[model samples]
Target: MTFVHWLAGQAGQTFASACVMTILVLMLFMAMKLYKSYRRNQTHLVLIIVLPLIIIQNGVLISLSDPEWSASPYLHIGYSFVSLLSFIIINFVFMKLYTGPASRLKGMPFFLMAIGLVVVTAAQIAYKPEMLSGPIAPGGVDLLALDFYGLILNFIILLNLRGVDQRINYQTSLIVYFVYQLSDMADSYVFHGEKPMLLIFIHLLPIVYYTLLFLLLFEWVLERLMMTFQSSITDGLTSLYNRRHFNKKAEQLLRDMKRIAIIFCDIDNFKKLNDTQGHHKADNVLKQVAEIIKEETAGIGTAGRYGGEELLGLIAAPGVKPEDVAEAIRSRVEKETMVTISVGVSISREGTSIAEIVSQADEAMYQSKTTGKNKVTLHPSVSQKRPRSESEGSKRSKQA
Candidate 1:
């Protein structure tokens, strides 16, 4: 029995050493990453976990020096407790920032956690005044109670985010956090002393799973940030380039001296539709119509909703006549759906300003509305007399 106990202690020391090395390496990597992106939230999160781990390393080393301290068993459990607390606090802060809402608990849990940590820290101090002299008090009820409470609270915080559809990355992190704790707990109590080799191997399960999960969460957060950056330049409802993006696109076209066609479209009686259909159905219709126009102009131009019922498209094809592009939009608007729309087409080869082009298209669209609706009118510069000989121009002009 003594021989087996000696062997187990030896393996525990090795495992503790490996964890310490891993902690050092992670800290170095995190510090380097922080130097590159000072404001990165991830750098801050890594730091939060790292701080607790550093404290844990000190505790582990002390416990290791005096095997009589029972540090072998408590080393993993102690750090896991601290880690679980830190993770919960960090995750809660993230949730509040993301949703911009105060946490529901009114700070009671936080108070309890602080008290528990204080009790544990004081217990550690009593157990070891000096690393040179290993002394352990049989881990009283208060000590065990504090550790168990931390674990339960961590689990509660995890469960709270389950049904909420916010910060999916954080939610995933919480799940990984829970799994890691569960596995660590299992290996510690059930497998640690019985089979040192198997316990060491099983210990790696949580680490690998958590490492992979953490990487995936990093990717997800990065992707979300990119999406938010892109969304700032886009319209929320129509998924079209917003006025800001349109201005930027126009400026680029002007710089390149590219010929462009600007078409303005307004849902012919949109106000009436909204009044009749109610806001909900009206919103659906607007989305549907916007999608139709988007599909029609796919690959040919950039389409955007210019707020409310107004939609705009910018087509840049240097030699392709502006009037021809306008005609295409006009034809698509007519045949695409049963919903009627008045379209104004303006083609500019002179590298004109976006404002001037939009004004011209707006004027033409209004003219279409005044002249009995549901048709396309080309800008006055592009043979605006309705093709005196082509009657289809005049024929479809009255369909609206």
Candidate 2:
């Protein structure tokens, strides 16, 4: 019966390693995809090398644990040592990534990990741990001494990685890894080969550890993909939808809504500001004006950077007057920033497409720019009167 239980334990170990091999292979594919997407990313580059090595190491373990012959004790020891080194490699690379994107790490952590690996290996060689071959059985502390040393070294690595981004939630994976290591060290001792119910933990814990790490990696990849998508659609300077994407969204809204409005805004004397104040100051003022436009258009509509110092807002909501929103944007820009903006509001009538409506708004904005610098104008096709209720809110801003 004792011999049967030991054989079962050995088989379970092989099964656990097989499950981890599948997870490592999946991780490798994701890493390769990430590297292909971002050639400059350091984390993805290291993962491409590390994951394949880890996968090969796992395969070596599975090959050595051949069920029929049970392999040699020395063979298992050699496989275990290689697996331990893989752990060190994986942890070191990821710790740097999670800390920050900057190259501020300066390799101190790598030095620490390398030194720990050397010391641990030297001690294991000198101590010559008995039965480094199979499940550790209940005995003197010396039997599990090397494992405890490795665990302590892992804890030190965790300390170095303490400032990881909390949003990533890596702590959960760390907890699982700790349990897997502890179970591996206490495997035969705790189960004693009789308690089969609890005995499965020794095999299953390794799989759980790998699965958690894989989930964390998947989440990281998802975040990078989302960021890439956002950058493609938005203006890098203003953080507003760029002209192309804005046009796409506006057309979609025009198709669904019975009536929509476009407000075109052009900054007054923007080139003069750029000439006198320098590009940096001009940029600051432009950002301030953009902020005002964004705030006024929030909820009722969306704003976009049309081009240069021009901006556009599209209102799709019913019962919302476009002329009033334009006046509010003009008033706020004049009051809150170093300069003013000339705005024009145009509403869609039956035959108008997004292009036609925007063209009408642009003509009205040109009217305001030519007649006087800082005010709002409504397209000739729409009523020119301001809503009386909102006029008091914008009374301080001069009109053309």
- Stretches of candidate 2 above 4 Å error? 1-8, 40-42, 60-73, 129-145, 166-168, 188-198, 384-400
Report the lDDT of model 2 for residue 75. Answer: 50
What is candidate 1's local distance difference test score? 0.60
Residue pairs in candidate 2 whose N, alpha carbon or C atoms collide under 3 angstroms: none
Model 2 — which ten-residue stretch has the worst lDDT?
A: 136-145
User: Candidate 2, residues 1-400: lDDT per residue as tens digits?
Assistant: 5744653566766777889989999998988888887865787788788888788777776665464333344555555566666777777656655666553455665667667766776676567755554543333223254477568766766665546664345666666777767766665356444665455675677688778778778877787789899999888878888889988888888888868899999998899889988999989888888788888888987888999999998898899988878888887887778787888888999988888998998988888787665778888889756422224544455332
Our model 1 lands, by Cα RMSD against the true structure, at 7.6
> 185, model 2: CA deviation in Å?
1.7
TM-score for each predicted model, relative to the true structure: 0.59, 0.85
Clashes of each: 0, 0
TM-score of 1: 0.59
Q: Write the per-residue lDDT of candidate 1 for residues 282-315, one digit (tens) a residue.
A: 6776776777667656666677877788888777
lDDT of each: 0.60, 0.73
| Worst lDDT 10-window in candidate 1 | 134-143
